[model samples]
Target: MQIWIFSYLHFLWALNKSMIIEWTHKRKNSHYISMIR
Candidate 1:
């Protein structure tokens, strides 16, 4: 039971980390496009 909970938490943390990276990348791309104009 403890191992299962630990794995679940780890999975959630990895998912959140990837999401944050993706969000930041999108934001940067948009900002770069606006600056070009």
Candidate 2:
């Protein structure tokens, strides 16, 4: 049961990390587009 909880937490952390990365990338792209205009 403890192992299952640990793995679940790890999965959540990884998901959060990927979401942050994707959000930052999207923001950077929008900034670039605005600059071009």
State the TM-score for model 2. Answer: 0.94
After aligning candidate 1 to the native by TM-score, how far in Å is the CA of 31 from where it should be? 0.4
Models 1 onward score TM values of 0.97, 0.94
Poorest lDDT segment (10 consecutive residues) of candidate 2: 1-10
The segments of candidate 1 whose C-alpha lies over 4 angstroms from its true place after superposition are none
| Pairs of colliding residues, candidate 2 | none
State the lDDT of candidate 2 residue by residue for 1-37, as single tens digits: 9999999999999999999999999999999999999
* TM-score, predicted candidate 1 vs. hidden true structure: 0.97
Best by TM-score: 1
lDDT for predicted candidate 1 compared with the true structure:
1.00
